[model samples]
Target: MNIQQILKISADKLRQKNIPSTALDAEVLLLEALSKCADEIPPAPFLKGGVLANDAPRNDNKRLDKNWLYINNNYELNKKEEELFNNFINQRLKHKPVAYILNRKEFYGYDFYVDENVLIPRPETELIVEEVLKILNNDRREQACLFPTIIDIGTGSGCIIISILNELAKNKKDKIIHNAYANDISSEAISTAKINAKKYNLNKKIKFIRNDFEKFLNKKSIYNSNEIIITANLPYVKNDAYKTLSEDIRKYEPKIALTAGRDGLVCIESLVKSVLKIKKKYKQKIYIFIEADPDQMSRIMAISREKLANVNLEIIKDLSGKKRIIKLLYCHPELVEGWKAR
Candidate 1:
């Protein structure tokens, strides 16, 4: 009958469903239904002080109904809103991520289309992107003319590489000569990545290749060193790792996109070794940015060091200050001409 009454009903339903962040979920679902961003929704106001649908001012009435939590808060949901809200809750109960249900995911400050084919992009991956951008932005030698080639390994949905281009193209539209590459072991994942790329009209901005990391490495016999920047969000979740994961993840997402291997370093091991050999051929340096499980980093670094001698290694931490990205640089002492550290 009122906003307070509707929230009570929805919140109770969510809690009973064992949904974490029940209140927040209810609020978001309702706000999205009305096509209103979270900021536009009214905060919980005075205890039961809000007006009813009919009695409330007309402008407030429409906005209020969109606030499904306020159902009867100040407006009533028309049929369309009612259908959407119900479908939203049904999907959530089945453990579908909100982004998946809405067919959208926010990444690097932009909303990207999503579907079952791609893993929902996480905020953590953005840390790797940030580190890569930091190195590019800090270069004093002119970021404009230098076309920095970038490759995203195991590029699920192409989120990492695409986000980098999106951010760069947003600002320095001219420093855009570099080729962008995205590779995924799974054909389906590659399809998903291409869809997102096409949606952004970045088909020309990035090249999508359906190949495994090992295959790509084997194929990189003639790559130039100065022309490359490698970034990856490898599946660090150990093969033995999935048993411990929540049912929500273990059941829904594609296995190839999640589990790396027996030690979770199987693919990573191959990548490090491949880069080491490639550096010799290229003669410049490789900017390596990657995400690894907390415990796996030490082993990854050790393996990388063995393969890449004299490579400057820096560990990147996420916003929460957890080490998430490993940035490795080659040719340290011989910093190219006017260039320092990149």
Candidate 2:
């Protein structure tokens, strides 16, 4: 069958199975299949005047853009492409996520390798990267010569830390010295994160630690910088809420990366406590950006207030206007008043 016909059939099958984003899933899977068949078939012809047929820019050289399918609606898929597309559709029908099937997810405009071992990077999580960049930029403006240490707690796919480093590397004027570390408890998750880090040529830029966050934080020797920035997208889904999540998420994504505990704040709470200890131990300027469910923002603020004195907290809303990131600024008591005014 041709591209158009096969896409319709696959989308219909997914729709029948009550899958969300049926059409998108179908197109993405077909594009991936087409990529695998690239060795057999030559690249699709460009449209008139050197413009892309679908008008969408190609991000991956290995994968064809979805618009290519529209441009080549009548193009016939060979046996290998047809077989691969069908296999992917079957996985989708079983409630698997498209990211898991593709083994890749895009975060902060960079694609990272992913799998069942790691949580698929979410769009909202990009807010953490944005916040971190803002902090780094602020340091540059103030001419803070001190090197900052960035720690990404529970770095499932190392998306947060890697993206931050990639952005920093892009700005030639960025003179801030910094260190980056990705810490996760799961060895498999660390392995997946390493693959992505190496993909972006960031293997040496980030240190991957397969250890619990609390334990890693206790090792004072690792944190040698006075300006420390922490970014975490830890599991904040309550146990009960986890059960109600869509089959695509619950069945395919790693559960340990999703659900926290009864209150959904187990991981965040522990992180806060550890930060307080670090704060007490070092008279340093610390900034933390944490992504959590909107409903849990107030509780997180309250926890921060109770544990750390003179810490300033801010809530950053996502595109949907949901409180998605909690920014915590804690520093030496003498500097609190000055930082709070900003």
Candidate 3:
């Protein structure tokens, strides 16, 4: 059958299964299948009345867009494409996420390799990257004295830290010296993250450590940098809430990357306690950006205040105006009051 006919059949099947984005999933899966068969596929069949005369400009690249499919709705899929597309549809019918099926996800406008081993990057998590960039760009201190180190705890697919490094590299005029480290407890996650880093030529720009964030923080080497920034997007889904999540997410994504303790604050609280120790021992300036469920922001703020006295905490809301990011600024005792005034 042709593109339109097959898409309708697949979409109808997905809709029956109650998949949220039925049409989109069908199109994307078909697009990927077509890309893989692009080399062996023949040209489009001749139209009877020059039907393609006013069609949108088609992209010659292997990954064709939805518009290309629209213009070629009558184009039939070859045997290989049909088999692959059917397999993808079957996976979706089982409630698997499209990202895992594609083995890729886009975050901060850059694509990262992903799989069942890592959590698929979410759009809300991009706020962490944006907040980090703002801190790096707004620093007025002398470049010579500022050795900025960015540590991403529970780095999963390394999307957060890699995107930051990619942005900094793209804007070369910012001459700040950057040291970056990413640590995760899962060896498979670290391996997956490394693949993404190398994809963007960032293997050397960021260090990947195969350890839990708590243990990784104990190393004395990270404290050498005077200016430290930490970005944590740890698991914050409560145990009960995890059960209520969509089947696609709960079934496909890694459980280790989701569903924290009962309160969903286990990971965040531990990280805060560690930061407190770092603050007490080192007089350097430290900034932390954490992404969490909007409902838990107030509790996080209270935890920060109780753990780290005089902490400058700010809550940044996502586009929907929900408090999704917690920005913590820690400075020397002398600078705390001044920092708070701003």
What is the number of backbone collisions in each predicted candidate, taken in the order shown? Answer: 3, 0, 0
Leading candidate by TM-score: 3
Q: Per-residue CA lDDT of candidate 1, range 1-342, in tens?
A: 333555567778878877778777776677666554323334433424454433432345344434334434544455666567777877877777777777788888877777777788889988887877776665553633455678888898788888888877777742643567898888888888887888777888787878877678666532543556888887778877789986557656767777877888877788888887776756555678878876777887888888888887888777888878888877634546436444
Where is model 2 more than 4 Å wrong at Cα? 42-62, 139-142, 173-175, 334-342
Instruction: Give a tens-digit lDDT track for model 2, residues 1-342.
Output: 988899899999999999999999999999998887766764455654576544443334557776667767877788998999999999999999999998888899999899999999999999999888876766454454667888899999999988888898897433464678899999999999999989988898788889999999998876787688889999999999999999999888899899999999999999999998998888778889999999999999999999988899999999999999999998787566766786
Give one digit per residue, the lDDT tens place, for model 3 in 1-342. 999999999999999999988999999999999887777667556554676512433335447778778778888888999999999999999999999999989999999999999999999999998988877765465543676888999999999999988888887623574578999999999999999999999898788999989889888888887889999999999999999999998888899999899999999999999998888888778999999999999999999999998789999999999999999998888656756786
lDDT scores for all predictions? Answer: 0.72, 0.87, 0.88
TM-score of each: 0.83, 0.91, 0.93
Q: Order the candidates by TM-score, highest first — what do you get? A: 3, 2, 1
User: Global lDDT for candidate 3?
Assistant: 0.88
Answer with 1 or 3, whichever has the higher TM-score: 3
Ranking of all candidate structures by their lDDT, best first: 3, 2, 1
